[model samples]
Target: MPVARGTKAQSTKQPRASKAPSVTENVPPQKDEGCQAKRSPSSPQGGPKKRSAFGDITNAHKNQAVTGKKEGVKAPTNKATRAPTAPTVAKNNEINLKKSLKKTPPAEVPVEHEKDSVPEEPVQQVPVVEDIDKEQLGDPYANAEYAKEIFDYMREREDKFLLPDYMEKQPDISRDMRAILVDWMVEVQENFELNHETLYLAVKLVDHYLVEVASMRDKLQLIGSTAVLIASKFEERCPPCVDDFLYICDDAYKREELIAMETSILRTLNFDINIPIPYRFLRRFAKCARASMETLTLARFLCEMTLQEYDYVRERPSKLAASSLLLALIMKNLGGWTPTLEYYSGYCAQDLHPLVKRLNFLLTYQPCDKLKAVRTKYSHRVFFEVAKMTPMDMMKLEEKLKS
Candidate 1:
């Protein structure tokens, strides 16, 4: 203790150890943390500084700090040397992402609401007509189903109001006699090129009047023949005389009686002489098909033949006409079928065969071979039925026809 002596270790360690104290203790804890975290005016530094965190530091400051010298340093008085600011673009992008996530989608438009908003205007929808060939339309006969419905309706109505027994018991005529009458009448329609509807109308009138009013004991043949006589005058330009009808009826009806009954029948029909026939429809359908005259003729023949069948008489006039025409065309080997008939029938392609079979059966069962001459003379067979008379009665009718 008398003399201050310098050790070799103490001298060397003194400067190095002293430098550590200044460097480690001189930096303020709060300020250092603020400088690294973010540059802000409200930080522990107490004043706004423009320098960024990334801004370069002066070489003099670095040297002084490394030497542990605090000659001019005052707790980093140049706070302007602040850390670089974070990217503003990055912060803004993050805010925008949050906003988008909270946004709602637009609502959908409703059909009814949109429709109500539109202006009011009438919309014209055109009817779609099938573009069938002219020939196909020439035959107007439709399906038998419609015909059946019509006939069924009529028959049911008739059954409800059965005629008097006196009227039902009208003179019986044999199948041959009826056939003979019908044949002649069919010829008459053909010769004059008369409408088949007229014939059907005449037959309908006869059947109705005979069942409802005419005495059963009276010759039913007379009533039938007279109904035709009246119908012909209404339908044809050239009507036959009462004598002509008498001749056709084989003298079964007198001129006075025929005239009287004709008046009665006319009254019953309400003078509605314009009976619609399938022939006109047949022509239309055949035209649609572009069919030959022979084809049309055959279709017409079929339509006329359909008239004799009890089913056709009961059917809708149009449908009966269409079916008949189709059957005729099929029989004649004419192709190019129109769907018009099928549409009316509400049938598929498969249903046509059964309809045809029914038609054929009806036609086959109703023979006209024996009535050829008589029907030709009358242009109508209103009172003829092959099944209604016996062979002896037929002979008498034949004898009368010859007379």
Candidate 2:
């Protein structure tokens, strides 16, 4: 009646075919694909995960479905057991990944936005000086290829302004009279607040002219003022007018006389007044010594005092600056000339000894009133009255010199 009942062969084939449907429903389509095909071709190991990122989850569901049938357990029929769509699963995962990336950087790469928020160097909260040992001399011509040539030119031209015959030329003028004129020049320089370089250059120009021309004591002031005028133009930002200088001289010299002397002095010096001075060397030495402000100020006071001595004209500016610095160091109770000073100045203690003695005599002679301008200027509160400081015992200085 059942048309050959239920054929035994047909019954077995039907059950086996039914099992194939259950396996296909549990496993994902992506897992059936070879790992090579599912991975990115551009990646070396096809990267960590690609289309098969959910392969493990898919396999877990597949195993549960297979075990349920073997153990005679009912397969889950809930919506939670619904087959996962590859497109939907990938989309959901992509969203979660994007959110995680925005939270924080998993990689060590620096963020551009973060770098802009931090400063490269810490800000200074207070005014402070650089370390003394780290302080260095300024080199303005450090980049100039012909810097040595320029220096050599300046040095070579210095002899042209030299008063080698200054003693011979000024027969009628005595050294003390020159000292008095220099003292008055110091007063003029201070009153105008001229640059120290200008003062030194003015003195140099005056000495140069003195070697070429003979002027009376009354005319000396006119000549000195004119030299200051020219030097101010060369070195000062806003040099005082010829009239201002004439007024400083108490109108003792007329404007026409000052003008005449300016022209004559320019002619006598051949307009070659761009010479070096001791101030330049002194500053370099002071920096090397790491000299304090007061020590440097005292050294300057001693150096400017040398202008009063006619004998100092013969010594080189470098030696004069070195001796003055050593004397200032000793006078200020600072250390003596250090090895650094000797190397930079090219003068050892033995070389500085005679010059130091000469400077000591000038300090001793300051109170006698022969040359009082420098002492008077430095005695003010602004200078800290370093000029009034007494010299230390000569015996100790001698021991230092010998050592």
Candidate 3:
């Protein structure tokens, strides 16, 4: 046996040498002394110093970097000794990690079933208003694009100007008195060659003024004349002057009285005289029915007749126009209330039947001597003598309504 260098002999006893060489036998004696001096003093002194597992791994990484190849590093075979405070630090870190996880909420993972269970908002559906002026695009005077919107706006404004049999509120006025005034206004419209719209709006102003202010029969003529003066200014491009209105009234009211009455009427009605009238709506609805000149004239006759009747004061202008046009179509043997008419006029035949029957009854009866202006106006050949035409019988009207 050969004694190892840098270590003390156990008993100074020499043993027989084996045929195999010792592990340090190939190394020179001077290299063994240099390696023993370079090792840490804390290593065991029994034999050559042992290298730590960290040193072996570091040396393997260096070898690989130099050789440009990855070395397979093995785990340490011996149990590692940790630092004195390592267990306390690890336990504290674990407890802190648990507390942080408890303080901070977990991420929200959306579940497919839960997502399906949530209710969605309902979508609102809007009512569609039809465009009836498409064919009149070439006619700039027709205002094709804005025609529907314009009529819709007028229909909306009708609610603001609505009357509720306001004659009941007047102490000095009766329905017959109102009818007489309206009849005279019609004659004034014809005599002055004022637009039909001028007549309708003049009547509207009178009724609206009467609704707000109490009036006597003596001042009624003044009110009527002032209304015409205001309406002519509104509807006529070359409206009749104040002198013309004064002349039409047979000088019943002086210039100052008429002018004063005009101010009174305007103030009472809050200066909002852009009233929706049956005449304008009648023309629009007649166009929707594609009514012939005779049919339209007859419808005009029906609408004008209602203007003189105090009973029709509560009717919506649009509804009155629709009902009048429907009756005209029936009398002419034209089709019943059409979808086009319903879409544009906002009334179906059923919706209009009650008023249509009333209008037919109006035409059926002979007018009294006092209220014959509307009948006389329509009886002219120039008006197609629509008043001379027979009214539709009640039974036939019912049959038509059913159809």
Candidate 4:
């Protein structure tokens, strides 16, 4: 029976092979008939078995490879060529598939695998506190979210840039000379239409540089101009050129001299000139109090006056700013420093009293005739003439502080 079955299969395959050409010649030129004829020899019986879609696709690809043509093209009928070519084509297809898979991005991880891959960390809970910037959420430029943190960072930086009474170390230079230089820088700042920050930073640079380097009286103006040039570059969007600084000096110092002094100052301070100044703190603290523009300007005038005073040089910039705002509040009859100011400024009313008294004394008893630049600049109507406003009475200031 087995011999009979083998003979039947051979007989059926031989007849199909013999009829393949005759069928192709008689049939219409249709792709289906051509594919049916091509696949007939691979079957053992009179008809081909039904194939799955995947088997059809695989067979189509093999036909395409063996014939070196696209799908729907006639496949070769020779079994010798088809059998040898199919394996090589299939092996090549597998190699190409592997290469393509390597080039493709990895598929998404399964949820179970993903969960096991990385252990989740516990989320940290931050302590809740009063948010001063809650109302300023719409104003991106206010940086309201970071305002408190930024001021705290500035307070920490204050310790690094703190100054001492360095006047005793310099024999040729005096506090009067330093004050005169700062006063002149204020005028430069105004004449150039630079930001008030430029003036404050310039004063800071000069103080820090002077703390480390001894200067002669003649080179003082050079130092001052160079400091302004550096500060302008740091703070101004469009800083004055070297030639502008030279002209401002009435050509007292050459361009090379100013440039050299700038280099000297930078090197002496190790190029860390981001010194905190009272002006920054004053503006921030004023916001805490919700101060009027006029009151803020008054605080600003007081802070600017302190720039020319050697006595206040060692004071922390935040404390100086807080005290100036406090003094301005009392002078305006706006009451003493409130809890908001104390909270933000980090100084209660009592912590500010000593500096408040000194500031008041400086405002009331202005003696330097040569250092009138700050006073003159603020006396202009543009600044609301805050410099011309009367200093608060000492007794009333004291009483306010006590209360």
Candidate 5:
């Protein structure tokens, strides 16, 4: 051993050959034997961990016990100790948060139900009467072999012709203005002897046109007369000439104006005029009710009156026609919507109750001083003077319905 002048002498003793580590050795340095993990008999030095036949749980217990007894042994001091249960508690909290999210209810979505998904909120329907016999209902149809099939075909397709929210969209023109137009068109239809389909389709075309274009209130009549001309061409084998429409409008509109308005309507509607109407439903329901020509005329009179109603335009045509026929039945002292009517009309009396009240009001409604054409026209003889029959204690009837 050498000693430097300013430094202390080095120790003469060297590490023993068996205790010193070689330069390339991988084995860990020696530790207290009593605190080390117990070695298994089959495990060679520096090999894989020895595990119990059952599981690692036995080794975990042994490690815990040995670590508890080795408090004197130094472990790394850098780690911060946490509560023994902190990890498990944090995991439980995370699980609870996930469960709360899963249990939270979501908003309801709208879906169309097959079995008449229409709202129960007083749909334009008629009232159900007490029990009555079906045998007493006289069958007036020439043939009703497949009337139900025809009703279903049209009813299924009625949704296509649904007009936009015109009352909301056409804010410039009031509903009263529309009422005046319809009242005047009724006279025109009667004067020209147009088919009832022509009138219904004409009204529908005018609504669709008004929905697409933002016309001033003054142009509303021109729109209506133009729609009538268009519908006549569609429904009549020989449609009225443009000049005839001018005569109906009292030449308030020139032929060129009518023609231009017709082009605008066809463009607005995309020329798609094969729309369903209340008249078709009326015919089908009349045949199903086995109604007399007088009864059909009365129902037609009631249905025609509704065209003047702005709110009623939103109603399904089938519903409107059913309401009218049901009212006519009660007025005529016939049963209140027998099952045969239900089977053919595809509507129960309850389905018509809301609409029935509306029609009753319309029937009993007195037009404003300026509007008397509907009242005056239906009061005539050819229409069976149904406008006069509208006063029959529409409120009172011996309503007897059969199951």
Candidate 6:
């Protein structure tokens, strides 16, 4: 090759071929050759590897003989190398970690199952006591059938005297609001331990006043609450304090507002403190019957309960109140109704059966979902004890009062 004048001449002789690279390339080749030698004679390259195998055997024997001559020993056989074992300390730690991960045993199962665990026991079916056997008062029509007379009287009263406008108008007290008031009253009764009659009277007074006086512009709630306050004073020996009432009301009404309302209620009733409450009549009649205190108390409960009934509006508050108390007393296993209970009490006793039957028809013949609030909310003193009264007597009394 040509070179520039300043550059050194290139060597013509090539470096010798390296045995190391050749040995590496031949490594797999050596294994392949060994494998071929082990194959059948039909292979293409089988002859050379077969001769090499015989040569290796001869060379191995020669090497053994040479080793025996030099050191009086034979060559060792080829064997695989073993991997190192884990340290004893590391092995023990790994075992302990596995043991720690294992779960522990649990505690006991309850023997007496909770009510929530199993289906609730079916509500016990209470056996009903028939009114005929349990009651001396007998059926409402036991003495006389008065439903037609009473119903007609009611229709007459509603048509003639109830103020057509008033009858048509749905008052400010919505069903929902009335429910709220009833619940609130029940809470007040429970909290204050007020007499059921007193609470009922308060409720009725509020209702009656609202029906008679309130307009769309008036706040009915204020009237109802105010009425309750007044009735509490009239009915209880130790009347609930105004602060307590305020607390019961959660301070929704101010002290001044309550005083103002009390004044307003007094003015509306024309300051007539003697409102002829049913409790007075109920107590008097119950005493005359020679009934047990339980009976009288029951009767009083029934009488007070009547205040919640829309149908009882036609009945004299006193008569309805008396009959209800009698009913409650009877339910309490007290003395039954007597003619003297009706006649002397001026309750139109002959008509009581029919009136009570009508009430029962209203209460029992259909679902009593509405009255449930009264039963569950109030002490249920009245429902269990009320007596029968005729619808006609109720109508007559209602007519006289409205007129």
TM-scores for every predicted model: 0.44, 0.61, 0.67, 0.67, 0.61, 0.47
TM-score for candidate 2, please give it.
0.61
Model 6 Cα displacement at 313 (Å)? Answer: 2.7
Question: Model 1, residue 359: what's the lDDT?
Answer: 55
lDDT of 5 at 102: 47
Model 6, 9-99: lDDT tens per residue? 1121111112122322223212222322343333343323535433433332221211112222221222111111223212322333233
**Per-residue accuracy of model 2 over 99-160 as CA lDDT, tens digit each:** 33353333312433245335643534322433333322254545344533554464565565
lDDT of each: 0.46, 0.68, 0.73, 0.73, 0.66, 0.48
Candidate 6: segments with Cα more than 4 A from true spot: 1-171, 174-180, 215-218, 325-339, 362-373, 377-403
| Model 5 Cα RMSD, 1 decimal | 22.3
lDDT of 4: 0.73
Measured with C-alpha atoms, the lDDT of residue 389 in candidate 2 is 85
Ranking 1 against 3 by TM-score, winner: 3
Please give the range of 10 consecutive residues that has the lowest summed lDDT in model 4.
Answer: 11-20
lDDT of 6: 0.48
The residue-by-residue lDDT of candidate 1 on 91-156, one tens digit each, is 322333333223312221143334544553333232233444433444558543354355345434
- Order the candidates by TM-score, highest first: 3, 4, 2, 5, 6, 1
lDDT of 3 by residue, 1-403 (tens): 2333212322322221121123113322222123223434233441121235224222222212111112112212231121113232223333433443343223211332334335432212323444568888999897898888999999999989889777778899988888889999999999888899999999999998998898998998889889999999999999887888788888787889988998999899888999999989999988877788999999999999988888898899999999998899888889888767778888867889899999999889845666788888899999999999988899998898788
Residue-level error in angstroms, candidate 1, position 221: 3.2
Relative to the true structure, candidate 3 reaches a TM of: 0.67
Which candidate model has the greater TM-score, 2 or 3? Answer: 3
lDDT for 152 (candidate 2): 48
- Give the runs in model 2 whose Cα sits over 4 Å from its true position: 1-162, 367-370
lDDT of candidate 5 at residue 2, scale 0 to 100? 15
Off by over 4 Å in 1: 1-181, 187-197, 214-218, 247-252, 339-353, 362-403
Expressed as tens digits, the lDDT of each residue in 57-151 for candidate 4 is 33433333222233225543443232222233335445433443343224212433454444643323322334568899789898888888898
The runs of at least 3 residues in candidate 3 whose Cα sits more than 4 Å from the true structure, single-residue gaps closed, are: 1-131
**Per-residue alpha-carbon lDDT of candidate 5 for residues 1-403, written as tens digits (9 for 90 to 100):** 1112112211312112221113113222222232223433233332222233113222222222122223214423332132223233223333433443343233211221222336663554644432222443455563244444665777887887776677776768988989989888888888899998999998888777777788788888899999899999999999988888888777888878888898888887787787879999888778667799889998988888888878788889988999899888878887777766786677888888778777777777655667777778877888788888844444453233222
